[model samples]
Target chain A: MPVTLKDVAQKLDLSITTVSRALAGYSDVAAATRQRVLSTAEEMGYVPNVTARHLRQQRTDTIGFIIPSEGPRFSDPFFNELMAGLGNEAAAHEFDVLVSIHVPGVEEEAAYRRMVYGRRVDGVVIVRIRHDDWRIRFLQQEAFPFVCFGRSEVPGDYPYIGVDGTLGMYLLTRHFIESGHQRIAYIAAPPHFFFATDRKAGFRQALAEAGIPLEKELEILGDLTQQGGYLAMKELLSRFPSADTKPTAIAACNDLMALGAMAAIQDAGLDVGEDIAVGGFDDIPPAAHSHPPLTTVRQPIYQIGAQVMRTLVQLVQHEPLAQRHIVLEPELVIRKSG
Target chain B: MPVTLKDVAQKLDLSITTVSRALAGYSDVAAATRQRVLSTAEEMGYVPNVTARHLRQQRTDTIGFIIPSEGPRFSDPFFNELMAGLGNEAAAHEFDVLVSIHVPGVEEEAAYRRMVYGRRVDGVVIVRIRHDDWRIRFLQQEAFPFVCFGRSEVPGDYPYIGVDGTLGMYLLTRHFIESGHQRIAYIAAPPHFFFATDRKAGFRQALAEAGIPLEKELEILGDLTQQGGYLAMKELLSRFPSADTKPTAIAACNDLMALGAMAAIQDAGLDVGEDIAVGGFDDIPPAAHSHPPLTTVRQPIYQIGAQVMRTLVQLVQHEPLAQRHIVLEPELVIRKSG
Candidate 1:
C-alpha cells in the first residue's frame, strides 16, 4: 500500500496541510517542520508520484533540447559547453533537461513533435536555426514555450539569444587587415547555416571597408570541422601557389577549422604566424591551448546557455521578461596564432 | 473531447486491436495498415498521452545519466564524449536520454531518487563510481536496473564495463621506462577516485619491475584537469630543481593533465619530447591536435557508451546476457609528446 500525506501528517502529529505545503517546498511552513516532514516522509517510504503530480499541475517541469549531431561525431566542444551551461542552469532552477539526438529532417521533426505534443516537457530550446527551419514553425504553431540559441531568417515572434557572428567576423577580418595582410582568404562554413552566411558577409564587409577588391577565388567553403578546415586551406594554397599573390592570412568560420588550417600551413613547411596569420571564431576551450593559442572570436557560450534556459523558464511560467530578444556581442581575442 | 484509440480505429474502419498494436509499435500489425492507422490518428488530432501509457506499461522508454558538474564548469571532454556516445546509441534504439547535472551531494541524490522512484527513466547509466558510493548502495537496495562506467571498491553484485586502468597506466609507465628514464615522476588524479589509486599503483609497479627504488616525493597528486595538471607539474619541477635529479618523464593520469604538463615543460624553457617525455591517459580528440600531439591511452569511449546502453536495454527487456561484466582494453597511442 502507498503511504499518503495523511499518514505522514499523523505520524508526525502535524496537520495534513502543513505536511503537504512542506513537501511542496512552500515557505509558509517552518524550517524545522519542513525538515521533520521530509525525514518522516522518507522514513515512511512515501514516494511522490511525479507523473501524477506533473499531470495535475499541468507542468512537467522539464526543458528539452534536440542535439544536432554534425556528421558522425557529436563531440563538438561548442555543443558540449552549451549543453553544460543549459544543464547547470536548468538544474539550479529545479528542472531537468531532456536531450534528443537526431539529425535534422524527418526523424528530428518527429522527435520534437513527440516531446512537445506528448507533453514530455514544459518548454524547449532549439539551436542551429536555419533560414527556413521547420522546427521553429512547428513550435510557433503549437504555441509552445521555447528559446533559441541562434536566430533564423524566417520571420517569427520568439525569444532568442545569439552571438553577433557578422560583427564578430568583421572585427576578426579588420584585425588581419591591420596586421598588413591584404591577400586574405576565408575558410567559410557551409552556406546552408544562417550564421555561416552572416559570418561570411562580415568578412566581405570588412574587405570592402578596407577598399580591397573581393576575390571570389579567395573564399573557400569548409564543413566547419578540423579536417574540413585543413582541406579547405590546402585548396586555397593550391589555388594561389605564389607567395606574392597567396593569402598571407586565413580566417575560418570557427576555431576547429582554424586549427586545421594551421596544420595544413605547417604541413606545407610554412611558419604559422611568421609566414601567414590564421584566425577563427568561437574560441572553444582548446583555442586558448592550441599550438600557438588560436586567435578567435570569444562567444559567451556558457552564459548564452544559461540565458536560453532562463528565458525558456520565464516563458513557461508566463512571467514578464524584461528582454526577450537578446543579442550578445562576440569579443575578438588576440593570441599567438595571429 | 480527447481522441481515443477506438475513435481513430472507427475513423479508419479498422479494429481497435489493430490501432492499439500499430500505435504501440508491435510487429503484428501490417506495415500499410499501421501507416494508414497512424495517418488517420494524426488527422483525428489524437494525442497518444504518453504518461498514461507509461503508467500502464510501467516503462518510460527513457535512459538517465546524472552529469557530475565540477566547480562552475562541465566542460570535461571525457563526460562530453561519454554523453555523446550514450545519446547516439540510445537514440538509435528509440530511447531518449534524460540528463540531470548536479554536484555530488544532496541535490545529486535527490535527482537520482526523483528519476528512479518518480519513474522518469526506465534505466540509468552511472559513471565515476566511488569506493563506497551511496548511489550504488541505494540503487542496489532498490534493485533497479543500472550500468556503471567505473568499478567501485565496495563489493557488490552488479554489471559494469570499465577499462583496465591499472594495465593501461602500467603500459604507459613501461614505455617511459624503456626510453632509458629511471627518474620518472607521476602526476596522479585525486586519491578519492577509484582509477586514481589503480593508475598510481600501475606506475609504481612499472618502477618496481625496473628495479628502480620508488621515491615518495615523485608521486604528485592532480585533480584531473589541465589546470590541476599544470599546477602539479609546477610543484614537481620546484621539488627537483636540479637537472641531474629532475625527473626525465612525467605520466599524467589523463590527457588534459598531460597537456598541462606539456605547457609547464615549455614554460620552464624545456623541449617537450627531448627534455622530458610526457604521457597521458584517455586520448581525447584534442590530444591528437595538441602541439607535438600527445601520447596517451585511447579508450573507445563511443563504443563503450553504445555497449552500456545495449546492456541496459537487454536487462530492461529481461534478456539473458552471455557476459554481464566486461572489461575493455585501452590502447597505447604513441605520438610526438612521448
Candidate 2:
C-alpha cells in the first residue's frame, strides 16, 4: 500500500491541512514546520500525488511538441534530431515532453488546443512554420506560451529561432555558378512554407548577380520529400531531353530531394558528379553518406532544437530570455557532389 | 475568465457539489441533472480542468516513452519511425504521449520512477529490451501497465511485439554463403541487448549449416552507429591486411553500421558490390536511399510501434489483449549492395 498525506500528518502529529500546505511549499507555513513535514513524509514513504499537486498549482510542468506529419509514415531525420534535443533538454530540466502527430490543418489545431486549453502542457515548441501561420495566431489569441523554430508572417514580434535560408541557398547557387554551370535547375519546397519563399528568393538573387537569366521552366516545386525530388527531376529531364538543353547542375531545397535527384540522374544513365553536379540544403545524415556525397548548406538542427526547447521552458517559467528572436547564420558544407 | 462549477450550479439551480459530481460522472448523480449541468457548462464555455479531473478519476490519460539515448546526437531512423507510429496511434485514441530521454542505468531508473510513481503517466512503452531487463521487473513489481517492443530474458510472460532477429540474420548469412562468399565478417550490437544475442545465434547457425567453421576474428562488436561500424570495419581490415585473409562479405547488425562499413571499404579503394558485399538489419529509410541501396532485413518498425502502443493502451484500460506475445517474421530486402 502507498502512504498518503494523512499517514504522514498523523506520524508528524500535525493537522492534515497544515501538513499539506507545508508539503506544497506554501509560504504561510513556518519553515520549521515545513522541514519537519517534509522529513516525516520522506520517512513514511509518502509520495505526493502529482495530479492533485498540479491541480492546486495550476501547472502541468510539461511542454508539448506536435510533429507536423502527413501520416504514420513520417520519418524525417531532421525532426528526429530535433526531438532528441528537446527530450534531452526537457529531462535535464525535470520536465516531460508531450508529443503528438497531426497534419497541418484542422487536426493540428485540435492537437494544439488539447495541449493548451486542456492544460496538458504549460508551453509548446512549434516547428515547420508557414507564411501567415494560423497556429501562431491561435496560440497568440489563447495567450498560451510558445516558441517557434522558424519565423512566420503573422504580423508581430514573437520568440523564434530561424536559420537564414536565403543565405544558405545563395551560397549553394553561387557555388554552382562559379563551377561554370549556367543551365542550373532548382527543386524547391512547396511555396506554403516560409523558408521555401526565402530560399527561392536567394536562388533568384544569385542568378541575377551572375547576369544569368532566370528560366521559369527550370524551377520546379516539390513536396519536400525524396519522391517529390525524384519526380521533379524526372519532369526536368523529360522537358530537356537533348544534351544542349538539359541542365548541367541541379540544386535541391533539402537533402532528401537532392538524394532523389541523384537517384533519378543515375537512372537516366548519368554519373552524379561527372555528368551533372548536384547540391542540397539541410545536410541531413544521409547527405554525408550518399553515393558521391552531397555538398550543401548546414543548419545545426539538433542544437537549434535544444535552443527552442530552452526558450519555451524559460517562457513557461516566466524567466528572462537571452534573445527573443534569433536568426542564425547558415554554414556551407562543401563535399564531393558539387 | 474561465467558467467555474459554481457558475454552472447557479445557472442550473443545482448545488455546486452536485454540478461537480455530475461533471465527474459519479453514478449517484441523477441522469437528468447531470445532462442539464453538462449542457449548461458547455453553453457557458466551461472547460473542465484536466488536472483536477485526473485527480478525481486517478487517470491521466497519458502514456510515457523513455528514449534510451547515449546523447542528444541520437538520430536513429528506427526510433523516429517507431515514435511516429506511437504518436499517431496515441492521437487516434485521444491519449497523449509523454517522452523523455536518458541513458541506461541509474538515470533511466529515475525517469521510469518519475513516470510511474509520480503518476505522470498511466502506462509506459518500453523499447530496446536488455537481457534480464530490470525495467520489466520494476514495472511488474509496481503493477504498472507497460508493453514492450522486444522480448526479454526475464522470467515471466509479458505483452510484447518482437521481430525475429535470429531468423533475420540466418537468412542474410545464408544468402551471403550461397552467393559464394565463404569468408564473412559480422558486426554485432552490444552484447547486453537481447536481440544482439539472438542475432549472433542466427549468424552462427547459418555458418554451421554451411559447414563453415566460424572464424572468431571475423566477428567484431559495433556500437550500432555508422561511426562504430566504420571503425569496426577498419579494425577488421587492419587485422587482415593481406587480400587473401580479408573478409569477402560484411554483415552489420543495423543499417547505420553497414553504411559506415561501406564508407570504410570505399576509403580502402574497394568497390562496394563488386569487391565486398555488405548487409544490414532494420531497413531504415536511408537504407533504401543509400548509394548502392542496402541489402537488409526489414522490420516493420512503424507498425510494431503502433501495435505496442495499442497493446499498452489496452493493458491500461483493462481491455482483453488479442495477444500477449507476438514475434514477427523479418523479411530479407535484397538490394544492390549484396
Leading candidate by lDDT: 2
Candidate 1 regions exceeding 4 Å error are A1-22, A25-39, B1-22, B25-39, B45-47
iRMSD of all candidate structures: 1.9, 1.5
Tell me the tens digit of each residue's lDDT in model 1 across A175-229: 9999999999999987888899989989999999999999999999998788888
What is the lDDT, from 0 to 100, of the residue A237 in candidate 1?
91
Give the Å error, residue B46, model 1.
Answer: 3.1
lDDT of 2 by residue, B173-286 (tens): 999999999999999999999999989888999999999998999999999988899999999999999999999999899899999999999889998888999999999888
Name the top DockQ candidate.
2
| CA error at residue B223 for candidate 1, angstroms | 1.0
True contacts kept of each: 0.61, 0.83
Query: What do the candidate models score in CA lDDT, each in turn?
Result: 0.87, 0.88
Q: Per-residue CA lDDT of candidate 1, range B240-318, in tens?
A: 9998999999999999999988888888889888998999998888788777789998888878888898888888888
**By summed lDDT, which 10 consecutive residues of candidate 1 chain B come out lowest?**
B49-58
- lDDT of candidate 1? 0.87
